[model samples]
Target: MSSSASDVAPRRPLLAGRGLLWEAVILAVGVGLFFLFPYDLGFLSRILIMIVFVLSLDLVLGYAGVATLGQAAMYGTGAYAAGLIAIHVTASPLLGLAAGAVAGAGIAFVSGLVLMRAHGLTLLMLSIAVAQVLQEVANKARPLTGGADGLRGIRMDPILGLWEFDFIGRAGYWYVLTVLILVLLFLKVVVNSPLGLSARGIQESPERMRAIGTPVYWRLVWIYTIAGGIAGVAGALAAQVTALVSLEVFNFDHSAEALIMLVLGGAGRLYGAVVGVAIFMLVEHVAAAVDPFNWLFLIGALVLAVVFFVPAGLLGLPKALTGLVRR
Candidate 1:
């Protein structure tokens, strides 16, 4: 809680070479699937966007010992920024994306000054409050955001003047995939850096970290800001794909979904973010197609099953299967 706590950096990942190899392999597989898939680029693109959101959550809730339910605040900030940029500044989606990131990060930094001060339920409450305020702002900004009707009129230029976002979503899929890859790489570097190690130390024992001359509070604030920036990127991705920004961008459900995806995938493990998003999106797609009115019940049941059977998440399912085979 002291200023000194914020001075300490986060802890880095323990594994170096083997971890990099695994990450490279996974990235290659993900890229290959994006290119090779024939029927469902939209679905995959959505998954990748959600993966970024989930990873951002992991950074705060899993790595930095902050519990928040208002991540959608940043996500919405990014989405609105992208939409605003597209509509007002330029039609270039990449420019809109950059604008969104800047807006998201700026909001995070400002919000972090206050939100990062509290812990436990207070932290959660502040987060929720932040999102609610953003939602209210979006609802009231009918002129700029089009209010509840949503901001529509965004026409993006071809990505890099080459690939256009199509109805088929092929280019969009690749774009999201590329961003996800870059975000993951950035997160890897961050979690392996000195700052990340301090985060881990704080997570394990904030009191101890503070006692040992670590700046626990500021470290948490810094991590929260970073995560918020990432969440904003996720929002920008969603805005790009949907081509609109609305009050729903700051909705409670958006934040809750990000949390569910993070928990479903597994906390602390980076790949768990992707795995959680993939499974969550796939289940939603299949289940909603089958029963639109009651898909949530099925999802709840599946989440319960995961809690009981594969607590580590869908990512751990493969390792569990391998263990069974070995046995």
Candidate 2:
């Protein structure tokens, strides 16, 4: 006899308990960082924003198993969309953020029509091409995008017309932290949902999933759209806080760095995104300060060490170490 749905429902409480534990850990870490880096809140805020970006990428490449290097396409599109909205339409930060997310999702949905069909090297190249095309279009629209000089005159109203964005960045930090927490919570629900399980199934074996009557292609496109929206939120946050948007937002480096951070923290685990961003950004900041002439070498060495030693990424370090000790 097959088990009823009610029989399996009881197991969710245990999973929810674990989710609560992780949420508490995240809250503790965020609170600790607020106190630990009072003097460098601006830099810390940037890390928080990147954490959002990396988290979005984790959703696509890690959970959805969509091998992509053009996530910056969605990111940059959101940035530009938010910046333009702020400049031309409304001074409302929230509205700009919404616009950014919509733009990202819309673009992703359109692109995924073609992108989700390809695989391997072809998929990677096509993703890269999309970003390049967007970059070129932004470049050519000199009047609209401000060309190489970057998008300026982006003024945002005080958040909710109450808390003013101050020089110390306390408001921005708290604002971003709140948004990050909310997004993380939403994603926790998503990754545990039936759709998320289907995504995992597709990732593990697309052929098998298809044979089981699953719509693998549409599932990917949906996840990709959702991921793009999340990435757009990150870009919107950057634009709102910085009060400027630049062409560099579309740069390939952003996409590459995000992927590295995801891998470093351990893809497939949501917390890995946060941990990876924190570690990578901290390392990059210190290394660049200490050896501005050749900081890349230090970064490269660190990545290599992680790859060779902690194949599961930094989140797996504890297990890796435990195994070594056992040996």
Candidate 3:
């Protein structure tokens, strides 16, 4: 039994290697898009930003097995933090990103202390409440957050103080793409690491993990905090590239959309986040253009199809098809 278990464990490392290879291929495709669709850079950049946000969600909900619908809480917190720093402190893009990351992690850490204690629907409700409270606070702090009008006048310095942000968005595209790749690479390492494996173990059988002396609660808090920082990086990128921060960043829709994207691609698998965002956004763009009134109906249909058929997500489609053929 021990030998069999050890043999099975090695397969995980092999899968990890394959996952990294897939990420590289995805990165190549993303780079090719810049030259292939220069006119759609703005829309593509938004997808890249969403990729980061969805990836962060994958970390908590997918890997840690924490069901949440309030990731926007951290996302909006990061956006506002970075935007305010840029407007009041300095225009350095890096600094703003750092501020956003720190602010996001801080909020997650504080909230996780309480929120992590709950489970099932209770946990989900508390998460939503945190986001709602933050939203209300932002709405009331008219002087600081810009309230309903949105936060504006954000000026970001050039990348490394060299590459200027042109009107065409080429710089922003490359910048966001680079950041996404780095984050992806970092997370790839993370999910394959011992820490990541432990998270997965906890997800599969928390009682067993606890029985083995794992500090499940603290681990969850750590991952949640890290995931929040990643989400913050996404929000900061949006603030800098677009030069505007809005309350909509904290909206429940943002979280819902992210969850959909993650499910569409296949959660717990890092590559799913990127692929899901790309597919969903492309469908949304084309569907909305085709029928402005009922684009969501198309999206809903797609989601239902995925849930019923390719339940593992788009990433698992090939295997799903293979199994079907074998049967």
Candidate 4:
């Protein structure tokens, strides 16, 4: 069951015409929505942040074939790092984000050293353990983390000394949108790079990749670290926008829901993350508004429908339908 590079890598270069067209479409849609929902910036920002978070997951569980339920480890660490820095030292959002990224990458590198060695159930369990440990530490360190009550007083300075974080969130919306675009563009490059190709090859078969002189172990760690940094950025964005960090950021539900979003969108296709998050969040928002207590039922039904009807995920429906047509 060997998969070729052509099979795993994107068909077209990221800078190709088609790729640029896709990027343009995303930009247009984002800007259009910005105008359409002038008042729901908070919600929009949440979706965008989740898009980034899930995008990071795609790089690991999707591209690298590393399936684990502990991504919240990096995410929670990033949020706390950003919040702590904002409270104790600097209020510069950019600085806080950098601190968050560094903290996430730091944790990922250390943990990946060991977790990447384990596979199957072992890997999954170890990943969960890593996150649980961090969560417990955060919970106990009440003096610094504010414990279960959550970390507060995360005031942020204006963006680059120009835009103020207005009460209505107009400035915050644009800030998040800009960062999201940058993340998408950066991942586009990563997905097309030599490292990216090696990661995919490793995913198909680590033993084969190792025989071919591909540093399989290091590749996994590298990609996982990169994913951690991105996840951290997402957490930082959440902390900065809300001006608070909470224990729930590390909840197992966060990682589980993110994995579900990846499944619904179609893993490995980077843009699929965006499509999945947008659809899932919109459904949840509407469902919760209509029936707060029963929203989970709607969400569960939607998940079941997607799983049974679109096994390849909603993003793959077009190609799946085309195959059936030809048959």
Candidate 5:
């Protein structure tokens, strides 16, 4: 083996164990929150769902260097698809999640073909346009999507026909948490795989990557599709837990807020997504409760502070501090 390869092989075990350590921390924190905030199980579930959504965005925007604002389009598509499945086809949650994933991936793969061709402002505009068109269609399809009122009549069966989703949401909380952990683990695997490394290379320099024989566009498309599928899972979770699917699922704020959280937590790191969601949601909750009408001011301030003072994001703060201390 080459000296570099030989040196790297021994560290693989350490890295893998580190990954497991982080995941264990997440699991412990999730369980603690579950018991501590039993009254806010529903809210906690929302945070978990959004964590999944932001993680998807991290894969595309942070790792793949894809600038986008239409992610909610895939998210809403999955939600509506899942809702329709539950009402017309079956009440099975598992099947509904699958439908959501497929719907999100389908939209992402189709739209990514065109969106990937554009760059800078044009790409952003095109992405926004795609989402706008979908939102309009959902609004107009009154009979199918319930238009402005939202998709109602969704009834999710117990998870695996065993754990009943009861009134207080104990079963639902556990279900969403399990999904979040699985998604996190899956993403950890993907981000460390060849495809993910190729994506990073493309992000660093698409021209260089292409010159080296990487199919840059195709790599992006695959990454975007994967992200969309994960976002769709988040959407499906939202629909199942709330027992309602609405046009608001396609709301621009959802995408914007998710992006903001991702940025705040630090985009490139997987744990950043989780931390960002938790901190953003927690602060927003407290701020809104305290200010009610002017909570946006606090949120804006927080984002600005992070951007100016901690460009590497909250997760990178430790490194930043260490650098300063050493300096």
Candidate 6:
């Protein structure tokens, strides 16, 4: 191997050595904490769903180098699709979930084409516009989506024909957790695949990748669509848990929150998304409990601290500490 290749190869093992271990640790802690808390399982379920949502953002924003603020559009689409399908078509949770994924992928495929053309602030603005349009559509399509009233009467069958979701939300918590793990594993595979490498290459420099004969635009389109599908799954999860979908599904705050989670945990790392959600939700809960209005102040300060001190994100801090310790 070339000297540079040899140098790079050694570094690969260090990155690999603890990623899985760290994931296991986090997952175990999440499960343990869920059981330990006297809190409602429904709340835990929401956090789990958010993890999937954040991870979806990580795929596009972190891996594919797509900076978008319109993720909620796809999320809301999947949610509504799942909710509508359950209410109007089939109550089977599986089928409703599929519908949501299809809806998300369909929208992403179309939007990615238009979004791929722009970059930087222009791209961000277009994404926001797309989300806003969807939110407006959801509002105007009152009869179908229930308008401001929201979609209700969604009844889902017991998951996998075994576990029934109840008001206590035990089944929902476990169900969402299982789904999150599966999605994370699937994403890990995708990111480590050839396609993911190309995405990284595209992110670093589309011009260079194109010169090397990579079909940059198409790659982006596919990646964006896949990310959308995942986000759709997250929406489906949320819809199933809440059994309600509304114009709020398309809310820009949803996208903004997901972005914050992605950044808080650290972009480029999948598990960072999960950690970000955990911390964000924890802080949110604590803050709201202490003072509803002042919670924002605490969160704002926390975010600023992370940005200034841990720019790589919370996930990066552990590695940084470990490196320092070793040195």
Compute each candidate's TM-score over C-alphas.
0.88, 0.95, 0.94, 0.93, 0.96, 0.92
Error of 4 at 320 (Å): 1.4
lDDT computed for candidate 1: 0.85
* Candidate 6 displacement at residue 61 in angstroms: 0.9
**Clash list (residue pairs), candidate 2:** none
Better of 5 and 6 by TM-score: 5
List all candidate RMSDs to the true structure.
Answer: 5.8, 2.0, 2.8, 4.2, 1.8, 3.3
Cα lDDT tens digits for candidate 6, 141-174: 9989988999888899999899898887888888
- The digit string of per-residue lDDT tens for model 3 on 1-327 reads 676666543344434555567768877998999999999999999999999999999999889899998999999999999999999999999899899899889889999998889999999999998999999999999999999999999988898999888888999999999999988888988898888998899789989999999999999999999999999999999999899999898999999999999999999999899889999999999999999999999899998999999999999999999999999
Badly placed stretches (over 4 Å) of model 6 are 1-19, 322-327
The reply for model 5, stretches above 4 Å from the true place, is: 1-15
Q: Which stretches of candidate 2 lie over 4 Å from their true place?
A: 2-18
Residue-level lDDT tens digits of model 4 in 155-220? 999999899998888898889888988998889899889888887887799999989998788889
Q: Rate the local accuracy (lDDT) of all candidates.
A: 0.85, 0.88, 0.92, 0.90, 0.90, 0.88
| lDDT of the structure predicted as candidate 3 | 0.92
Ranking by TM-score: 5, 2, 3, 4, 6, 1
Decide which is better by lDDT, 2 or 5: 5
Off by over 4 Å in 3: 1-19
lDDT tens digits, residue span 156-253, model 1: 88899999989988888878878888898889888878888888888899999999998777777788888888988999988988787888889888
Evaluated at residue 261, the lDDT of candidate 2 is 91
Rank by lDDT (best first): 3, 5, 4, 2, 6, 1
Between 3 and 4, whose TM-score is larger? Answer: 3
